[model samples]
Target chain A: MTASRENSSSFRNHTLTVLAIVLLFLFLWWADGSMAEDLGLSFLPEGLNGYEVQILNLVAVYGILAISLNIIYGFTGMFSLGHAGFMAIGAYVSALCVLTPDQKEMMWIIDEILPSLAALHTPFWFSVILGGLVATVFALLIGIPVLRLGGDYLGIATLGFSEIIRVLIVNATPITNGSLGIKGIPCHTDLFTSFIWLLVVVFCTVRLLSSNFGNVLKAVRDDEIAAQVMGINVFHTKLFSFCLGAFLAGVGGALLGNLLTTIDPKMFTFLLTYNILMIVVAGGLGSISGSIIGSVIITVLLEWLRVVEEPLNLGFVEIPGIPGMRMVVFSVCLLVIILYRREGIMGMREITWDGIAAFLSRFGRKKENRA
Target chain B: MSLELFLQHFFNALTLGSLYGLIAIGYTMVYGILRLINFAHGDILMLGAYFVFYGTTLFCLPWPVAVVVAILGSAGLGVLMDKIAYRPLRDAPRISALISAIAVSFFLESLAVVVFTGLPRPVHQPEWLVSIITIGGARLMPLTLLVPGVTAILVAALLYVVYHTKPGLAMQAISKDIETTRMLGVSVDKIIALAFAIGSALAAASGIMWALRYPQINPYMGVFPGFKAFIAAVFGGIGSIQGAVIGGLMLGFIEIMAVAFFPELSGYRDAFAFILLVVVLLVKPTGLFGEKQKEKI
Candidate 1:
């Protein structure tokens, strides 16, 4: 009877957590729509209003990227610096799929080729999924050889891979459109759609983390040799985690591409990877909640700094004439954080209901003891 | 590519490879002693290049004097980095050290940008070094010849220092067993600092040469070479100096030749390094010259 009661109570807590998440998602969605309407923001150039909504959509896209990157770097304890490459692969592929049919009609050479592919037009959503699949395939291919190598070696390999991808994108003229970049891509990303996608990704990610597989992933991260000895196929586990991470990164890239309505090789550089890596490190490794917090903090801080550098200059205290002062300040903050709070804000722990309950219980216990 | 172009490209590869080898020596030396990969080493190379640029342009020093000053400056910076960023994390987990190293790398790059601005400065090579020398059918710059010769001499000197001197023995002992070396009355900290100092000096030397060859100096220039040199260090065997040199040269040769032969695949130059790294790791995780480590349960 006691065991059944405990099970029911746990089930109730799980349902409550789900309900809370759902309510939060709905609130965010409503807020996003209302903000778009209130500000008269549009996601595209054709619309006069909705600039705020477009920015919000961009934030959601980057938030997805940060969360996806967290899966590989934070959750799996893998130091991958090639995430931008995976993102580029997805962006380029989707751009190609979206542009090829229309491009055939305009370009002489493309029109002479198999007209059937040109006839079968793909929607933005289909292109996004295809982009993600292509990126996932690339991840698997790249991960197969490098994932077995642990620590710094993997980091180096991934960095090399990303650079390689950038070069390939630049060279593949017919596919990636070369240095000119793939322009006139369909703009399908908006605040509502982006928020919905973010919710799905966050939900799936949180669910995956709470599952049995998540436990195994954490175990492998804690000690790979020990985990391997205990019968977990360490290679497969890493590959799965890395590929899933890559897939989400691909989706993020696709959304970003759609939002911008263009794809450029230069857009996916090591700098992008570094920025995401910095966010993950600042968020706290191996913590989902930390990633969300870090992404919001970094994105909002970066955007807000534009105002700080411009019209909001303090009177009688003129700031320096340097253009990239914000980046310098950001780097200093990163160094200070690493130097002092090396474990980050929350360390490796998560923000869970149990944690909150424990804190409340401790406060009550302290009061009782004082009495 | 034509025969002449192919030969020139090969020589170009060799010159580039030698510089990489020079930098890889520093990376291997530091890793050998501490088992920690210093991500900031490449930025130190950038610092060296900038120092040389300033010494030559601002201070009106001769090329040789500028080189010497740059090398010394980089060595001092390396020691400072160790003291500030890495020394405290020695007792922490390896991952923490890695993160700290990364943070230090970002800090250095940002600091460079703040000081120098993001503009790419032109590195003016001395006219004597810039003059082309034709050997038989091939054309070569004086700098190219100087690079290989200097690299070979430096490697030889490093080998002699590691094998012939008492300090070398102490370094080797610490690498083999840091605790045992300390128990035997060796100052492990001083020896390790010495290794970093020497490594930083070499990296600075390579950086100066690289800037002269490329003729462009940017704050973030070290990112690619730093990563490639790390790959080279791994290819040769992380802890081995000779291995690093060989690995670096091989990588340089492969990258240049690959681009020269297949102009269509020129963009894949970095990919070749990545693929080479992946292949090397898959085939031999211990590396070409590395010994397999057996851990006690």
Candidate 2:
């Protein structure tokens, strides 16, 4: 096809993709538990129960988070373990914003709510954006000093930062309610908003990666020395990637808090970061599609894995559920992946139709050869 | 604070700092040889504590015997962690090894939860160590002074081994240049394992002392000390043993002193270590005793 024709066709494809997503939202919204039951469409996949819907919300939140981490660690080659910290900032910011004064009054049992904070409130959208912006601000401050360090030093430093953030949140009783975390924050996130946020983040990330800036980021990741030799201003590029990732992570955290309708210091810890890292590494470090796909698999798997924590039965005997078995299994799986298959599911490759066709053709060829 | 109070805090700082220094050595030694953070080091320290917990309670072994057994078990575990988790990733990307270390850390933590249960159990503090002694109008347990003294002696013995032994020389040579040392007919893997063994033993010792001081044992107890010790290692210069100990002691003093000076900010005690680490890393990334590293083109 000619260049203009190709552009027009691509634009049409984009429109179709977006419209398809919108249709999905409309269907989901219309077919929610009550609606579907009334309409006699309760058995349909779209008529998800509360728990199933939660998994979807978690997928979207984690999809966004995994993408952010993928960009930082996969595309830009920065090993950051601060997503949990950023998410906590976002979660606290958004929760505090959306909560009414009465709710704040009820929740702050440890100390009286600050008068100014009690008065301050914002729409969910505005509050979420503010959370992202605030987290970005933190990332900017932290990145300026820390982006200079390389490898594990940067890793440890970022980990330290997240711990520090948690510590601050725990100690700053007036602001974060100290260890007695906020409760009963109004639920603001649903499938529609979360998916929209994920789409926007993924779209922006994809566009950014395809641009000149993305190339510079990959260059810096592959070899900082070579990128610097080519005059690519490595520090600024790294700082940009770090800040962007933090901003998205912050947004994800906000959505998570709203979805859970609760916020606490204990919730955002290394394990939270570890969950996102597992998704990122499992999906493929540098691929956006990989993150989404990985998010779906890992989220569903996490929910499914909860079965191990419940009582089990055999023909002859019953065994009590193991409390921490899920984490053990998850860690072992990750270890096997890291040890045996370091590239993960997608590696550096994206899921293209052409690639899919090629994979199928190879499968067909193998079948024919076997015959 | 009164003079007696100040002295008591000083002893507290010394004991805590020595324990931190002990754990920090594990991190520094591992980093010096592998250039890997051994994220599992803290978890290994946790395992060491758990081992002691079980040895005394499960087997009814004497405290000293249990301690020795726990240290040995930790050493074995450290070496096994290397052989299994890290060995295959020798040629892989450095981050792969790091992620594996992370996996092992959580695996041990969750495993502890599974085996030892998630609840925090009180450690068995021997009567001799728990006994109070008065010094300069400051009353403290015998364990306080014993902890630092024991740590000092272990560190000195470690220094002598690292400087005088053939295996220690091999470890130093490998850290400088793994390939060159390999070419020089050194058993690099064995030496690396040896380093892990020693580091893990020290971590276990630190864990035991920490348990005695706090009189509590839990799966997650190692996480904070592990982090602070790593910070200490970095502060002292990541690859330098002496630097790690000094860094550990300094960190302990800073944390205790800062809390003592401002009781209101005691809740932010953990933040002090992270902030100190960030500042030290920014000022001199190589740390106090670390040699300057030049980036190669």
Model-by-model DockQ, in order: 0.61, 0.90
The weakest ten consecutive residues by lDDT in model 1 chain A span A107-116
Model 1 pairs whose backbones collide: A40-A49, A40-A50, A41-A49, A41-A50, A41-A51, A42-A49, A42-A50
Task: State how far residue A325 of model 1 sits from its true place (Å).
Answer: 2.2
Question: Which regions of candidate 1 deviate over 4 angstroms?
Answer: A1-55, A103-120, A307-312, A357-371, B1-7
Top DockQ prediction, candidate number: 2
For every candidate, the chain B TM-score is 0.97, 0.99
lDDT value, candidate 2, whole model: 0.91
Q: A180 in model 1: Cα distance from truth in Å? A: 2.3
Among all candidates shown, the one with the greatest TM-score: 2
- Provide the interface RMSD of candidate 2 in angstroms, 1 decimal place: 0.7
- Candidate 2, which segments miss by more than 4 Å at Cα? A1-16, A19-23, A26-31, A34-46, A357-371
**Minimal lDDT window, size 10, model 2 chain A:** A30-39
lDDT of 2 by residue, B1-297 (tens): 899999999999999999999999999998998889898888888888888889989999888799999999999999999999999999888999999999999888988888888999998788888888999999999999999999999999999999999998998998899999999999899999999999999999989889889989899999999989999999999889999999999999999999999999898899999889889988988899998877777
